[model samples]
Target: MAAYSVADGAEVARQVATLPDGGSSDSLCAGAWLSAAGERQAFNDDFTLLAGTVPGPGNKGKTATAFSVSGGSPVSTGPGATASDDRAPVFQSGTSTLWYVTGDRHLTSRDLKQPSAAPADHGTAPGQSFLLAGDRPWVRAPLEVTPDQAAVAPGGTVAVGSNLLWRRTDPAASFAEQNVEPAVLGPSLNGRAPVPGSEAMPACAARLWFDDLSLLCNARNTLLRVTFAPDHSRVDKVETLIPEEQGLIPGAVLSPDGRSLAFLREWAGTVDLYRLDLSAGAAPVRIASLAAGAPTGSGGVGRDVRVIAWQ
Candidate 1:
């Protein structure tokens, strides 16, 4: 059954839909963005939906068909539409600029308002790459240290990876080679370590930046709230939001107000959606049962169930 709901967890009317390629929905990769007028617009990677041929592996092809969330026929963004190397397009907040990485790995931006206009190519420096921290674009230097995860602060500070946090004060600046002291995890509630003793704790990858100094992260199967020192030199504190005992949390999206987090948990061949209030000691409540045997994408986030937007 297809489930559609509002932000309040109230079930809304549902309409049946199919992929443009006539393929199972499992192969679809979808995302959402807010328009200038605050309407939620959704896009997906079903090339045929726009009458375009799907690109083969590592080939550049037109993707990203835009549609209304309230219900409407999907529209093609045009023949030139493409996404980043990851097959996902990053929409800039408060603007129609769609930022993505081209097949050559160069950072590119296209204006959705004028879909046919040529995209602006922001050439990456030799041995460098670009990424989106929230809605802001940033360049990672020396590309050798490929970050497993990253997050950007409002003032331009960026934290990459967990354990030994790689940090930089500005987008154009090189990362500080010195290892910042690792975040100290709170004691395990069940007296169990994430891993066996002395094997190194699981890396807590940043999922979303809560503010300029703090972010929400996922370490193994747990959620952590990490706050950095003012100088960005070391972790000031770490609080366990969701313990690892709850099972694997593959993906999560924070509410716009930062008061709640919606995440996907998988176990026993079943996937479920749960929402946790950020309030003190709040627990996650199962909101919906997604699908059985759902396929997970590159980062282990389920492709069958995606949280497009949280109003």
Candidate 2:
């Protein structure tokens, strides 16, 4: 894999590592993120750096690893370091604490400072979740009492579900279900409806904007910006950044400044990366083509590329 600068799209660094299932020949079951200081933390089903001799056993599952952008030897947290699940391991951001779901479906956390120690069990894992940043940091998992997927704003207000926006300011508070009015499409696309028989998409892959007043989500094969009322009582607006006609967006990440979004889209057997400025009426600009081969996995819709992080 290679690291490129978002500013000029210049390749800055490249690391050759051997991934499980015959390197890149199989589905890339891996994820990575960069720290503010430019260090990369990543995980793979089984991985080995170019300098390493043996790859981790696939049966042991995903292994957590670390690398430096400046170039150096990579480090692995070792076998049994993480759960065998496909979900990417999430860091607390700016801390040594990491969070992941166990094979038994338990949400667990452990500190890198104590790598060999047992992880602290949090509870049953949610259907979907992400880190909620604040003075009191916590994992924004699905509500135990409800089936809806949830995303927590920086101020502690939670937005639940997709067909409708449900608001609950506190964990102990009751949710106020609110309807999300149809998106205000452009004149040429007015009155258009979702493809027939498509299931309602959830906001599980949403990123809380830096401002915290809105969420940038890739759902329904489109990019949307869901804005909330200042009081956090209801959703004030829902805007489509990129329409579904574009293609299947496997993943997206917000820029550090929250002014742009980078995502991976697969269309016509080709996967390409695109960046969009959040400005009004701005169009997406193609950055790179990730892959051009016969689609893999079921239904021939599996994505070969994924956006891990924007920073």
Candidate 3:
């Protein structure tokens, strides 16, 4: 059966027997991958930063060496390491040193400063590694509202990129805050910006981020730049404009690093994916053509595009 009921108070219904670590299925050091959201979480190999694809193929009948992202760079964690299409990252609190992974069956964390050797089994299970060295989950809250985008901020704060909202767990109180006060860096948040009198969109899925004194946001179809005070007390929106339609998604995020972006565009009745090179300041570069169908009036009737980082 695809679905089955478990015993009362039990999470697992049936356990699939794990195969032994040899026969064409296991790779040495197989369970290490990383991620971050809205922030440039660098992927390091043996304490060295990885740019694009790194190495290692698992003993399993799979080319473990190939780690491709819809947008960013990736590094391999060895055998039994979980592969992920969604790679959102966050750093450990009280330290700017190590980074952690957010989305996956098991929440994973690693020290950026630690050499990229197969992480030791510091976790409670046999293969699981220590995510964040703490007594509890890194993010402990009352299952509050899901964030559209999140970034690890200074002073151990996870900054929700959209809505300019902030939330943190007060260790003394031992609970997560639901309604975090707003830093209010842009008008696009919550669609509070004045209605545009021009031919523009109503701004959906705004991407808000903080960097140094710069608070950046991408709204409607344009990127808005801003600045913040040292105290996180004052914020100002500077300017906004649409980026060139290169290899960038119109509504989804390509690369938060702003170095490169990937987008799905419709052409000849099919949705094709492309990558925009922000460094070139021109139209997007074509990475690969997505499958498309019959052509409509001018272009193919393709579905919208979606892109995500990988771990």
Instruction: Give the TM-score of each candidate.
Output: 0.62, 0.57, 0.39
User: Candidate 2, residues 1-311: lDDT per residue as tens digits?
Assistant: 55557766566765554334422211133221111111112322122222111123554544333332234344455435543442334445445555555556666665655768766766665433333232222334332312212344555554433232333434442212222332211121234333122223343344344456776655647876766567544456767788667577766777878788887777666777789898888898888665543245444554434465675
For model 3, residues 137-185, the per-residue Cα lDDT tens digits are 2343112222224443434444534434444545223223333544333
Q: Which scores greater on lDDT, model 1 or model 3?
A: 1
lDDT of 1 by residue, 97-160 (tens): 6555555666666665676787676665222233454444545422222322344466665454
Q: Evaluate all candidate structures by whole-model CA lDDT and list the values in order.
A: 0.49, 0.47, 0.34
Displacement of the residue 232 alpha carbon in candidate 1, Å: 1.8
Instruction: List candidate 2 segments past 4 Å from native.
Output: 7-10, 16-89, 100-108, 113-150, 159-207, 292-296, 299-304
Clashes of 3: 25
Inter-residue clash pairs, candidate 1: none
Q: Positional deviation of 147 in candidate 2, in angstroms?
A: 11
Question: RMSD for each model, in Å, please?
Answer: 8.1, 8.9, 15.0
Clash pairs (backbone) in predicted model 2: none
